[model samples]
Target chain A: MIYLRLFWEFFKTGLFAVGGGMATLPFLYDISDRTGWFTHSQLADMVAVSESTPGPIGVNMATYVGFLTGGQAGGMAAGVLGAAVATIGLVTPSIIVILMISAFLQRFRDNRYVNGAFYGLRPASTGMILAAGVLVVKAAFLPDGLSAFDWRLPVLAAVLLALTNLVKPTKKLHPIVFIFASAAVGILLELSQ
Target chain B: MKELLSLFSTFAKVGVMTFGGGYAMLPILQREVVENKGWATEEELADYFAIGQCTPGVIAVNTATFIGRKQSGIAGGIAATLGIVFPSLVIISLLAGVITQFSELTWVKNAFAGIRVCVCVLIFNAVWKLGQKSVVDRWTAGIFAIVAAGAILTKISPVAFVLFAAVCGIVLQTLLKKGGVGQ
Candidate 1:
């Protein structure tokens, strides 16, 4: 049942999550909320892991969530199987859609209706991604309540934002480097405290 | 057999080297699939990328599937997909197994705390970039505003939002065409 549920959940994610890896965030957040299979905190970790590692972030997250859920359901063996199932579930839609597109590539590409739909989807997907970002911000900075607000974390986030954006030299640096550097900063902050 | 093997290996290399996200895979995919393997031309790869964007699921997987299917057949599509995700499955499973075990530790928790904030920033950055590209006109800006607000305010499924948006898009386009206004 767990494996079946895993497949079903990820199948929905794979099928409906148009756009790219980041676009899957809302679905993943929904999955976390609905299933309790993973926490928001854990979702952030998965994002970190997915982003820093090779491969598509969406696929990485599906595998990570599946592995964790399956491990809890059975053991490491189930975990591996769950990872495969979830990953396949994630990509199954792409395979099916691509196969269909390949058969009628010209017509599909030239269809004005398809283009218009995409034109609409582009902004809508961006909105969803923005909403997902807001959710992450809430989860990370306001998990408990506003009363327990931590200023240092926000400062760290701002610094990272600036480093990745406004800063000249650091702007072009890969995100993995920032993630690793943040990890070290986190550990050091903990040590200081 | 040889064709499928090459398809798998080529995509496997793509899978392993792709860092960040699907967009990050573009250059590597260009090199492997176009320049080296000659599976797809530059324009063909661009088409795949465009289609992959609007299609469901991961763009990288979609592109790989397209290239694979083009090369061999449906079997090649499966091979390429499997190859692309194979690295993710193995690598994520291993990391998840190890991370779950260590997540309880203080250092790990703190590290996650910092990483979580960093992730928020990254997601925000992505939104900024996506918004720049997608929210080009008044209609799209309207869609973005409404969807953003609705998504945050309501617990409605994201799937519903996407479907509704697609329908709205088609309808709006029809209306514009009837009105003789250009998109």
Candidate 2:
């Protein structure tokens, strides 16, 4: 049942998550709320892991979530199977749709309605991703709504934001570098305390 | 048979090199599929990227399937699609197995906490860049505001929002055309 549900969830994600990898975040959050398979914090970990890893971030996330859920349900073997199921579920729609599009590439490309839909979709996708980013910030910095705000994480996030965006030397650096650096800082901070 | 293997291997290599996300894969994809393999021309790749953006699913996977199908057939598309995701499946499965086992450690927990904050910031940057590119005019800005507010306030499915926006785009464009207001 878990496997079936996993496939179904990712299938919907793949089928409707237009834009790119980040577009899938809202759906993953919704899945977390519905299934309780993972927490928002765990979803954050998945995002970090997915971002730093090779291959597409969305595919990495789907595999990561599926593996974790399956490992919890059964064992390591089930975990691998779950990863496959979820990843396949995620890509199944792309494969089908792309193939269909391939058959009529010229027609699809020239369609006025298609262009119009994308014009609307682009901004809407951006909006959804923006909403997802806000949700992530809340989950990371204010887990218990506004009442229980954590200053330390927000401060860390601010420094990181400055380093990545404001600092010229670091602005062009790969995200993996920032992620590893943050992890090291986290460990060091914890050790000192 | 040879072509299928080549499709798989080429995409597997692209998959391994693609860091961050779909957009980051563009240069690598251009180099491998266009410059090296000649599977697609530069303009064709751009077209694929544009189409991939609107279609459902990850843009990188969609591009791979597009190029692959153009080369051989549906089988080629399947091969490339599987190749692109194979690395992620293997790598994440291993990482997930290990992380789940050690997630109880205090140090591991702290590291994840920091990583999570960083991830949040990264997503914020992505949203900012995307907004700059997509929210060009008044109508788009309106759509962006409405969707963001709806997503934050309601528990409705994100899929509904996407579908609704698509319909709105078509209708709005058609109305504008009829009114002689060229976009």
What is the DockQ for all candidates, taken in turn? 0.43, 0.43
Q: Each candidate: fraction of true contacts kept?
A: 0.75, 0.73
Candidate 2 lDDT over residue span A5-53, tens digit each = 9999999999989877878999999999999988999988777566556
Chain B TM-score for all candidates, comma-separated: 0.57, 0.58
> Any runs in candidate 1 off by more than 4 Å, and if so which?
A1-90, A101-106, A191-193, B1-80, B92-99, B178-183
Clashing pairs in 2: none
Per-residue alpha-carbon lDDT of candidate 2 for residues B1-183, written as tens digits (9 for 90 to 100): 899989999998888866556655655665578768999865465446556766899988999999989899999999999989988888887778555445556776566666667767776775665566677789989988998899888967666887888888899888877889653
lDDT of 1 at B102: 54
